[model samples]
Target: MTTVTKNKVTDLFLENAPSFGSFLSLREESKQIVNEKGLPAAKDEEYKFTSVSKKLEQVITDFSTAKPIAVSKDTIKDHLWAGFEGSYLVFNNGIFSKELSAFENSGFGVQMLSESNAIALGSIAKAEKDPFIALNTIYFEDGIQISIPRGKKVDSPILFLFFNQANEGQIISPRILIEVAENAEATFLEHSISLDEAVYFSNSVTEIKVGQNSHVHYSRLQNDGSKAIVVSNFETDIHRDATFTSTVVSLSGDLVRNNLSLRLQDSGCVGNMYGLYLLNGKTHVDNHTNVDHTKPHAESNELYKGILTDQSRGVFNGKIFVRQDAQKTNAFQQNNNILLSEDAIVNTKPQLEIWADDVKCSHGCTTGQLDEEALFYLQARGIDKMQAKGLLLYAFAGEVLEHINDESFRNYIDGLVQERLGSNF
Candidate 1:
């Protein structure tokens, strides 16, 4: 009988040897931590919501270094970045492609980082254990670093473009780190688009640290192919009196998982998180968010909604933790979903763990089908059954979409939802 050995994450690290040699001195330490502790199993309290064991098992077979992949601007303009203005940073196969990017260095302090300069920042270490992040740090050839001078307000939105070409059976990992100076304000838009029909995997991580009293707005649009699989993690650190808001929209993917963590480290900080996911076919989408309030008077609000049709599945796990010293903290979370087909499945969990008794915290979740009365009322108003259903679904999602502060972006998302619903409107 022949035996097949499953590839372990350790194997990927070993084969890539030199790429990860940067951590060689600590390889033994990391290996011990990973192999012995490894990634938490499905039972791990932190990862209990999403099962990554089977997914992690799909490690690289040979583990060779990645070569630069060429991309063209004309191709990007024709396929992605169709409608948008401002700066664009394009990356392919986890390597930044400068030719495909455009920038206006008009005094906002936005510039690409020289390799040496990025290394000096010393912030990348926070993402070391993230497998994809490790891969990017080791293999990533180049990436853009946007630095807003202290107190500079970036009026134009900065867009990060990750394009996955038609590379069948290949995996890509992209890494990004943003630093916002005190009292700085900026908006970031990241989108992944591809024209290929192959089943590619995009594993990426983004870390943002908001300086004291700074404001950062981040939005991610995941519009990969239905056959594509993606895993993304975003972590942000908010300082005193800073505002950090993020919204994620997942349109398509075979299996998509997004993990977002926000650490409110100082008092008077505000954290806001919102997500919308639509799943169909056999696609599975999971959105998990964690908010930690470590100081007094911090506030956090989270709301997520999902729509599952066909035989697809959706999951949402939102958690809030208030430390013992985090008195007067206000935290609220809610997750709602609608299942269109009997075969569709939706799992939603909203949790709050508070150690301070003087805090006001609340969490609630609901999963159910469409309102029959609302549908009947629309139908009675002369709307066709399918059209009526689409309208109701749009209205249900509009409440969440309305929270989006940007009107143009909200309209763009509304158009996407309308097209997905197949409503003539």
Candidate 2:
């Protein structure tokens, strides 16, 4: 047998990263964190259920080189939504593609990170807490910064398309920073997809700042190829009277981990989070969320659901923090899962840490199979077993899907969910 050299993933990435750039100081700081903490292992409490680093090492042999793949306009059109009239930004293999992107109006300001001076780039989603975030800060080639002017309401949603087509095993990191001014309203959609079957790892970070009296709606769809390994971090800060809502849908991937953090900085801020993960084959998906209530009168709600089949596995850990001064805070979190196969498994934990006595905070989780009585009742109505199962599962997922505000995008996601379930609801 030939001798194979093994190296740490952090070392491999550091060796391939550039030593000079405008973000040199920030990158160096992140580099030191990565070198010191490295990727989370099984011993890490936060990542005990998922081994994303080991999965990366098994599929990725060369992290330094990326094979050139041409993506034509027609290729992009194939993936576009049928009736989407909103603005769109495209990223090809972690690099922003201006030629392929389209802006329908000047309602919002967009700038490339390399060309703009973004003071809030590393503010919300600090890299020191997570190794994946640190790696993204170190490896990201280009990113986008979006700003919504004060008092402006964007009529159409903004869609971010992250497409990856790599022949060799490489790492792809995409970064996004969005700032919404006071009294502004905007919606954003993030979709990540892979066109090839190559083994590649994706580490992405997104930070959003919601200004006072503003409302922001954000959604993310992760539908990558079977050989893809993905780790994503999303952090947002909500100011006084601002409202933030986010929905994350994980459909397919070999291994996927999502970390979401929301901070309510002032009174009257509201944060809402919803997530759905449908897994089959040997896929593993982990979702971790944190909602912090710092000021009084703030509110937060979180709900995440998962359906696992075959030998797939799912993990959900959600936490709510009510600080000492966060009186009159109303925070709730829940995670529910349904396992369809005997070999499938799910681990769910919902926690609440309250330092204030006046706060109304509660968290709970449940994991079990589909209700046999409900299935039987559906079968008794002359519905086939498969169709009954599909309808039941669809109903289970509908609660989360209904939160999606855009009708067109909601229908699109509904169709994808039906297709994955192999039946219409």
lDDT for model 2:
0.88
> What are the clashing pairs of model 1?
34-38
Tens-digit lDDT track of model 1 for 113-231 = 44435542325334354544444444444455667779888877877888775353455767676888899898888778866766665767677888899988887778888777778
Write candidate 2's Cα lDDT for 188-267 as tens digits: 98888799777888889999999999999998889999889899999999999999999999998899999999999999
Candidate 1: stretches off by over 4 Å: 1-13, 17-33, 39-49, 56-70, 80-83, 109-116, 119-141, 166-168, 423-425
What are the clashing pairs of model 2? none
Cα deviation at 61, candidate 1, in Å, is 5.5
